[model samples]
Target: MAAAASLSVMVLLCLAAVASAQLSATFYSRSCPRALATIKSAVTAAVAQEPRMGASLLRLHFHDCFVQASPVPSLSSLILSSPT
Candidate 1:
């Protein structure tokens, strides 16, 4: 199970790198002007409250992507939904 999860993460990371390469620097500027700043502030506050929260959040994201068996999940959906 651990190895499978790790492989999933590796595959996703590689796909993300390739997909990100096609995105423009200002891709979200017109669609969501404050998106980056909002994300940065939220992450900064979470990490400041608990340094380990950063890694925990990342692990949760990966788990959401690969561990869920029903109702296919996507990173954007996970980000928009309640963390609990």
Candidate 2:
């Protein structure tokens, strides 16, 4: 009985992993840490180039991260709208 239970659990886990493997086009960052730093620094330096663009990108990333981390759509949207 225990062996069957474990096997069923393992099968479910494998299926879950397989189901989640698909990713959206935008999430492909070859170097995530470097990309994050680049985006942050670009915004920080945007006091000169495109002021609003930097801020907008930062907000978009923050929101993107939140949704990816937490799939509860309504909660993510509400938090995204709230003041940063």
Candidate 3:
């Protein structure tokens, strides 16, 4: 059961990556050189604080991609539109 869930998350990530046109390793190199490392650090910190947070984030990503056809703006709107 856990393995299947892991595979589902991986597949969702791959699908999102493929669907995104401008997505690339160096997408933020010029604009935000430390973006990847910064994200990694944050995720590491969150996971260290609570392992389930990692899975929650992955699920969030999957839903974001599933609901929003586009990546950045839609996801941002989806998140921001929520009542604080």
lDDT of 3 by residue, 5-82 (tens): 556556766777787565687889999999999999999999999999999998888987676655434435544555
Per-candidate total of colliding backbone pairs: 0, 0, 0
Worst 10 residues of 2 by lDDT: 71-80
Clash pairs for candidate 1: none
Q: How much does candidate 3 score in TM-score? A: 0.53
Off by over 4 Å in 1: 1-26, 69-84
- Best-fitting candidate, measured by TM-score? 3
lDDT of 2 by residue, 1-84 (tens): 556555655676676668766665556366463776786776678756866876677677898776567643343444455545
lDDT against the true structure, each candidate: 0.75, 0.63, 0.74
Q: Candidate 1 has what TM-score?
A: 0.47
Residue pairs with colliding backbones in model 2 are none
Model 3 whole-model lDDT (C-alpha atoms)? 0.74
What is the descending lDDT order? 1, 3, 2
Highest lDDT model number: 1
lDDT winner between 2 and 3, please give it: 3
Relative to the true structure, candidate 1 has a C-alpha RMSD (angstroms) of: 12.9
C-alpha positional error of residue 22 in candidate 2 after TM-score superposition, expressed in Å: 27
Angstrom error at residue 39, model 2: 6.9
Q: Where does the lowest 10-residue lDDT sum fall in candidate 3?
A: 70-79
